[model samples]
Structure formats: structure tokens, C-alpha cells
Target: MFRAKPTFVLLLITFIFGLIPWIKAHNSSLSFCNRTCASKHGSGGLTLPYPFGFSDGCEIKLNCSATGKATVGEFPIQFVNGDGIRVNIQRKCNRSLKTVAQLFGPNYAPTANNAILLNNCTEAAFPCEIPSILVQTHFSSVSCSDSNSTISCYSERNKRAFIDLERLKKERKCEYLLSSISAESLNTSEAPVSLAVEVVELGWWLEGQCRCDVNANCRELVSPHGRKAYRCNCTEGFEGDGYKAGSGCRKAFSKCNPAGYISGKCGGTTRIVMLVGGIVVAASLTISLGLIMCCISRRCLKWKMRRLTKRHLSEATGNLNIPIYSFKDVEKATNGFSDKYRLGTGAYGTVYAGKLNCDEWLAIKRIRYRDADSIEQVVNEIKLISTVSHPNLVRLLGCSIDYGEQILVYEFMPNGTLCQHLHRERGDGLSWLIRLTVAAETAQAIAYLHSAIKPPIYHRDIKSSNILLDQNFRSKVADFGLSRLGMVETSHISTAPQGTPGYLDPQYHQNFHLSDKSDVYSFGVVLVEIITGLKAVDFSRPQNEVNLAALATDRIGKGCLDEIIDPLIEPHRDAWTLWSVHRVAELAFRCLAFHRDMRPSMTEVAAELDQTRRSRSWGNSEDNTCTPSSEVCSSSSSSNVSERPLNFHKAELAGRRELLTFGEKSHVNLAQHILRD
Candidate 1:
């Protein structure tokens, strides 16, 4: 039996006993161990390795040397498909035997008659592996090293390897070859290998299959030594070192970098751009809103200024002396006479520069009066003014009656009043043409009042102070506070003599009878004042020369009209101009005649002055002669002035038929005393 070793022994035994059936049977069984092992498979459906298989055709995935010993490999052990993956033998000793076992293998399987058992087990307390034996025991049938257990034959050298039990028993080896159940062997999901096994193998132990593919394992099996160890395997359809990375079953997936979405949906870059764009749009809108607010604020400020202007205009218009603004039109223009739109003030009530419904401006005179007498006078004056209309007249716009206050509206005269031009010394240089235009215009207006209007109107207060100039310097007769109108054929308006001082008719004052000649007397004084550039009765001047009319008469008789004319007239230094002025001066003297019949009518006087202005002549009309008056004159006279000493009565009748008429019996001597010499 020991003539040769195992390589030669198998050949010699096969040849020498080739015809012996029992010997051939044993040899054939030995041959079968070379290829396969026992017919029944190992646990986990895998046939054991050579000298350790459970089927006729299974062979270990390891090289056998001539001595029938397994060769070593890097990671030689691996579980079959559907087997709880684990190494086949003690990991260190069988490094070459590339076989694997189930997680619930024969070592800890239950025995036939109980709940725990072992493979090649002889004693219940100490299980041992035997190369010649197969185990079909349940994992829960046996308990080791306890009472009621089988023989306690423990040996350490045979603990992990397949230790042929007949050899150990014959060699009488005991304590060093013993083995015990590992604590991790009870974990059903882990194989009987080390805890360092791949998760795929552990997964297989739990699910009975490999979860990884071949190329993914990187030629590195993860199974190590001891219980709970399992073989490494990469996941199907993937490739990597599953055990090293601990990603045992990574599935194959596409890799992309700097690539777009296949469906053209928004990418990361596009999303970022969209977000930034949205932010920019939002910021721009915010800035635009702020700018709009600033513009709106400026616009609001301008509107406020306009509103303030309207308010001031309204306040002034409310207290004007004249009816400068129409009630309906002004109220409609300024939103119902609202207090929010006042203008200015003066001696009258508030004066307003009002815009009419027709877009024309007007000066509104609002006058205040509590007494019934004053109110009656204002109403009467308004009625008289309403009855007349002339270009030279200050046109009445309308009137307002509200809250016991009277308002007269008139067309706006942009050039202001003649008083401002004459006495106020406004900054604008007044040319002689403009001044003469004012005088000529005033004369024409007064003449029109005395001649044109039916029954004739007499402007009792005919002073530079009562004249207003338009933007074109056209003079207008304004402020008819003392005007009167009645039938010319009859006596004048039956009222107390009412007129400004120095301009009042002396004849009308002594005898309470009004006549057209009263207006002529006033015109004479105005003419003297205009030529001399002096006030009618200026108390501020030297008392001897205080009365402008008397001073002019004295100077004229002495051939001193040159010394009395306005100094501002020196620019027009022609003798013809001086002669024309002297002629007008003489006519003014005649108009102031003390004899009522001798005084020229406004028609005669206006016609003579017009002709004199046109011709620049000194021709004498019968009614117009420089006859110095001997007595005071009534400014209301436009026909005849009462004379003192000169008995021109039959003499005046010698030239004119109507000499001593109605209102002609006044005492001339008394009139002379009051004429302010």
C-alpha cells in the first residue's frame, strides 16, 4: 500500500486490480472524488469542492497537484448561483480551493432528531468536520457543550478544516482540534465567512442569489475568514471594485458633464440666467416708480401754485368798488365765487381780476355798505351806468348782490387809471403822445356822454382821477360815483349838488337846479389842470396859487400861458403847438363863463376842441371866447355858466336867442365870492 505515493498509487491500483469488482468499486469511488464527491449536493444548492463535493460531476475551481493537493489562488472561493455565498473551507488553509458554501450550511444545521446539528459531527458538544462524511442536519437541532449532549470529544487542530474523523481518531488527537459555533453564524443573511464580505454576497445569503456581475468585481472576491463572511460580486450591468468601494451592487448609469437635457428643458445655467433677469426687471420697475413719483410731486407743486393764484384773485374781487366781474360768469369761472380764489384789495371792497366765461379778464369792484341810503345811491348809480354804453366809457361787465354786499364788474383796463399816469409817477416813461391821447380820449368820452346818450349823461366827477386807460392808452370815463342822467329838455337830475370838490358846479350849488352847463364848468377846471399839470385845488401848493383854474386865468391874461403849461411839454417846442394850446386855453376860459347862456354847450365845446386839434388854429367860435369868469362856476354846466359883473344877458341873447332860461336866477355876486380865487 505504501509502495508509491498517491499519483503512482492510483495508477498501480487501477492496473493491478483492474478485474476485481470490489477493488474497482473503491478505486472508481476514489476517481469520483477527483472529479466530484457525494451524490447529494451541499447546502445552498452547491456541490462541495474536490474531496468535498456532494454530486458526481462537480469539481473544485482550483488546481490539483500530483499529490492530489489543491493549489492556492488570490480569491479562490465563491458561492454558486442561488447559494448563500461563502468560502468552502477555513479561509487561511484553503486559500487555493475556490469553492463556496451556503450561509445556513451543515456546520450549524439542525440534526435529524433535534433542532441543532453539525457537519461530520460525532459528539453533540464538539462538532468536527470529516472529509469522508456528509451532513444533512437542520441548523437548529443541536446545542454544543451542554448536559444531555453526546460525547465531549473536542479537538482544535480539526476545528476549521475538513478533518477526516477516522484519521484524528486513529492518531488519538483531541483537544487542539476542537471547534464551536460562531455567534455571527446565527445571522441568516450573512454567510459563514468573515464580516468583511461584499454586501452583494450578504444579499445573496439573504435572498439566495448573487446580486453583482463578473467584470464589476475587479477580480477581487470579498469573502474572508470566519462566520458571516461572504464572496464579493458586482451588481449586474455594472463594473467596479465593489468590495473596495463598499458599493457591492452599483447599477450601470449614464454619465454626463457639460451636457444638455435630452428633452430641451431648462438647464442649471438657463435657470440661473432667468433668475437674474427677473431680478433685474424687478429693480428697474422699482426705480421707474420712484422717478414717476418725483415727477408727480413737481407737477403737484405747480398745481398748488396755480391754486394759490386763483385764491388771491377771488379775495380781491370780492371787495371791489366797481362791478368789475359779472356775477354769473365770474362765479362760473371761479367755481361759484369760492373763497379759495381771491385777488387783491383797495379803497373799495376786495378787487378781483376775474376771468369771465368767455375767457376775458375783468376788474370786479365789490363795495361794502350797511346803510340803506348808501345802498340806494349805489343801486341808482348802477342803473344810470347800465343805461349807457360808449367806447370811451368804462364798460360795466355785470353786478353781484350777495350777502348785503354790492359788486360792480367792468372790463379790465390793462393800462390802469389816468391818476396813475399823471400823479403816481409809474416807472414806465409816459410819452407826450400817450398823454395827449389820454386827454383827447377823455374829452371825447365826456363829449359823447353829453351829446350822444338819450337825454344826455353828465359825468360830474371829470378829473384825471376818474379816467382809466386801456392797454392801447385809449382813455375811458370810469368811476361814475357822482354821475347823473335825465331828459336834456327838462331840468337835470333833481338831487342835491353831488360832485368832487374843486370840480362841483357853483351855479348848481347855489340854486338847487342841475343843468348840462354844470358839466362844462367842471370840464373847464379839468382842462386848466391838464394844461398846467397842476391839481384843481391843491392845498399843498402855495395858498395864493392853490387853485389851478384861477392861476391859469391870471397867467393867460398876462400872456404867460407858456409859463403855466406842463414842463414835460418842452420837447414839443414849436410856436404852432404853443399857439394851439393858447387857443385851447382861451376856450377853457369861455367854457368857465359866469353867464350860463354864454357858456358853450359840450357839443359846441367838443366840436371846437376837435377842430382846433385838427387844424391847430386859434379861430374863435361865437360861444368859445376867452372871457374870464367873474364868479364861481358849476361843474355840471355844459350849456351856460353863471357870470358875475358882465351883463352879457341881453348881450348873450343878442348873439344867442336863449339867454336867461330856467335855473338862471342865481345871485351872481354870491357865486363870485365862492369861486375860490
Candidate 2:
């Protein structure tokens, strides 16, 4: 009997394997019903439905009329002579031909909008009448005859089948507009069943459909070939009642977690065995790999940080230390350059009140080397400033060039930088007249550099902080760190991009080519700042809306220039003063034009400022120097020049001397002449 046990198991396995195909076929029916996988004539989703296809192969055209022709939705529909049924295909609503013979019939027109009528047809043979075209685009009427024979087939011999002639005739006529048709000869197929019949009946669909099948429900039988339709009750976990007696949906076994399975069949011992096995494997791998890497990285980080820290500390604090001061010397000065004894820092460097060897009060700039591209630049600055002399330019007293440090001493300007008077609030400041005077002095200084100096020095970085106010409130142009001297022949020089961001010239920013016009642009930005009391680069607002120059220009155009003008300067506004200020703004705007060629020369800018000052009676003192010499020269110029004796020989000698001195640089001057001669 024990030997027979193994044979019994083999036989059982064979029986299950043999039933698989039948079970699958039965199960497919239980899972996906006719409604889920409707015939090709049935509508699916999207465009046209499946099976019928879209072109001539289908019984009905996808979007065509009943006659199967191209037509819009609302129109007279052509008809095909056959039973038709309306069905959803793809996502759109459509009609389809049920029979293969009907699709190939003469009533079907491949090019026509809908089907056309065939002669000699009766209502009894094809009960369905063809739909009238009315306004429908794809529908058509069909004609059928009474002599048509209905074909029927059955797998079971005992089951009698008969065709309804009257219904067929009516349906064929109506088929022109309908979607799907039931034919006598067609066969139905289904998938296998897996579960007990009683469980399938408890499904939601069966519970709703079967009043008698609350505990056990009946489902409609679907045919496979031509056997009689049959029904069966559903089993547990199955949703719908089965169509056949024994075949129905079966509960699928959950193999993922056997103990937690709905049909439970496992234990805690198996789970613990797997858990321990996984932990041992994971820990062994992790410990071996981690220990090896940890030792290597721990040594590397310490060495790297020590090297980086030493390098950075040297750069930050090594060269920036102040000179050693004896206690007595420090006490004597400041009253030791004390808080009260201090003068404010300007563009040149910090200004401190200190007592020198002669016990003289002087403002000392303890300059540290900012960036002396080369040791040669330190020599160049010392040589350049020592040789050049201009009344309006701040004078360099003495320099200490030691090690990597360079210091320049200058006479004190007690009142501080022009930025404070123009931009500072509170009581200690200049009035309107003094402000105008300062602006005039600053313009005169720039003009002197542009026209009077030999080979001309451009104060490339010009801003309010660089303009220092003396005790007399006179403007002195200071700070030569970013300054450059142009040879007479070279009008522009290539340079690295460097400057305050907002006040930087657009041309210089784009091309890194520096010219005198770039200075004009920076000055323009500063002038706007003076007038508006706004920062050149303010990012407190939104990211998209930057650019102070464009914003101010927009306000000026709107006749709301006063809205942007500093409140401190508001009380000084009058018709003539406003005109003069607007004139300056206009010049500044021109100076700030994107194209360097469009901006006025620094000489012209100075001339414009001088003209405005004179015309407005601003700073008219003898020393003001804001008056235009052109008016005086123009009125008496022609007769006086002709009357005076000519110095032609002297002029000739001077011109020759100048040419020889300029040498190759003369070509640079000629280039500028070609541009603006």
C-alpha cells in the first residue's frame, strides 16, 4: 500500500496537468467577461474600436457613414445592405459589420460615405430598417430580400437551433445605423474556470444581478462553438457566477508569504530561519569592507585640512599686519590717531591723524599692497605720481615701498569724502551752493586730466568716495590704483575686467577693452548715484528687476525725476537748478550709453558740466574756475587773432618737437583723430 502511495501521487499530478487547458479556458471567462473584451465591433476607447480595424478590411468604416464614405458627423449617411450594430471602439462611438459575408457584399462602397441600397429586399427577411441619412454623416439605409437563408451550427446534436427570419430582416435594415449584429452561424469562446461555483456567485456583479443567488447565484452562460448555454454558482474569492455547472473562478494562491496567505499554509520557524541567514551574510560583508576604508580616509583628511589652513592663514593675515608701534609713540599720536583724532578713509586708503617727527598733524594712509601685479607696478606708481603735478589731483607726499607693502602719504582733507556730503544724512554737511561747487570742482579736475595733462591719465575708477573734500570744500580727484595712462597713439588698451559691478562699463565688461570712454561711463554711474542717492548695486529687490540706470532713466522720462532725487537735495530744486541737474543727468545718460562711441569724450563731459555751472550762476567766485573760456574766446577771437603777430616759426619748431617726442605713439593719436578728429 505504501508503494501504491507514490503511484497515486503521480496519477494525481497527471490528472491536474490534463485539466489545465480546460481550467484556463474556463478561468478566462470568469475573469474577463464579454463586456470587458467585447468583439471587434464593440467600442474600446480612443479612436476607432479594434478587430473591425480602420480601413476597407472592417465591416464598417471607422469614422465613415453607414455606406462607408468620408463624411462629417452631422450629414446624410450612406447605408450598407446588411445587419449593422452600433458599438464603441477605441474611445469613439462607431458602427460595425457582424458577418464576414456582409462586409464583402455589393452594398459596401470602399469610397462611399455610407452604404447604398440593393434592389428587391423585403421587411420580413431583414426586420431591421436602415437608418435615414437625415443629418448624420456616416449612416445609410440598407435593402434586403425575403429569399435570404439563415445559417445555423451546433456542437450538441440534441440542441435545436432556428433562425428568426423577421428579426433578421429588420435587424439587417437597421444594421446600416447599428453597431454590432448577432448572426445564427457565429460561435462563442471562453477561458477556463478555476474556482468553486458557490464562491463565484458571491461577487458584486452576481449579488446585484441574481435575486435567487444571494448565497448561490447563477450567471448567464456564454457559448464555445455551439453547445447549449449553462450556469454555475461562484466559490470563495471568486467574483462572478460561472456559466457552466462545475467550472468557475477559483481563489488564486498567494505564494509571496505562505503564512500570511489568505489560504494559510506556513509557520514562524521558516521565517526565523530566513531572517538569521540574511543577517549573518550582510554583517560579515559590511565589517570587512568598512574597517579597511575607515583607516585609509582617517589619515587623509587630517593632512589635507592642515595644509589648506596654513595656506589660507598666510594669505589672509601674513602681509596685512600694522607696523610695530612703541607705546609712547602710539599714545602721542591718534592722541594716538584716536577716534576723535581720526580722518575718514577715502579711495586712496585709510586716513589717520598722526603726529610725525616734526610734531606736525598729518593724515597718514597706512597703505598695504592690495594687488601689485608685479614689483614693477610699485615702481611705476611711485615714478608716475612723483613726476606729474596737478593742482586738482591729490598730491602724493612720500612712499614707503618695503617688502610686499607700499604706502603713500598725502595731505589731510579734514571734511572727508564727497560721498558723505552728497549722500550722508543728519546735520553736518554742505548746502546746495557748496554741493554745486563740489560738483564743478570735480568736473574741472577730470577735464584737467583729460586735456591738460601730457599723454593724459584716465581715472578709470571714478566714484564719490574717490572724490575727497578739503577743508575749503574743494574737490580733489584721488585714488590712482586703477588708473592708466594712454599713449597719444593708443586710444584703447586691452585689460582684465575689474571694477565695482554696477558702475562697470558695459563695453569694458563685454570685451575687456579699456578706453577713456569707460571712465566716462563709470563717472556717469557715480553722477546718477549723487543725484538719486541710490546704491549702484542694490539687490534688495527682485532678481529680474535690477539695473539702476535703466530704472532712473525710466523715471526721468515719466517727468517723475523728483521722485528719485534725494530728499536732502529736494529743498534746493528750482526751475534753473532743475534744468542744470537734468542737463547733468542727460550728460550722464549719454556717458552711460552702451556703445562707447556714443559717449562724449571726457573733455566734452567736463565742458558740459562747466557750461551748466556757468549758465546757472553756480560757484562764480574767481577761484571757482567753472566759467567757460569759449564765450570769452569766441566773442573777441577773430579780430584779435588776426591783429596779433604770427609766431609761425615757433609753432613749427614746437610741432616738430612734439612729433619727435611722441614717436610710435603718434600713430595711436592718429587713430583717435580718425575716430574724433
Lowest lDDT block of 10, candidate 1 = 130-139
Model 1 agreement with the true structure over 185-288: per-residue lDDT tens digits = 32332322221211112122211133333444322222222334233445578644344323344447653322333233436464656556766888888788
> How high is the CA lDDT of each candidate model?
0.49, 0.47
Candidate 2 Cα errors over 4 Å, as ranges: 1-349, 358-360, 369-378, 402-404, 425-429, 488-495, 541-546, 557-559, 571-573, 618-677
User: Residue 351's C-alpha lDDT in candidate 2?
Assistant: 62
Give the TM-scores of the predictions, in the order they appear.
Answer: 0.41, 0.41
User: Which 10 consecutive residues of model 2 have the lowest summed lDDT?
Assistant: 195-204
| Candidate 2 lDDT over residue span 1-677, tens digit each | 99999999999999999999999987775543221222345444223221122344432333444443322132222221112222221111223223212322221211111122222232333211111211121112121233352211111112223222233344444232232222222222211111110000100111122232343445543222223332345555554333232123444554446345323344435566665577688889988889988877866764565445435433533432223223344346557446786566543355667765555555555554455463344444544555456666787654443333444556667777777766564236556556666666777777777677777776677787778877788888877766667683265545445555567777675566777787888888777777776766554433322456666656654545666666766534443354455556656666777788877787777666665555444322222212111111112213231211111222232222111011123222211101010
- Evaluated against the true structure, the overall lDDT of model 2 is 0.47
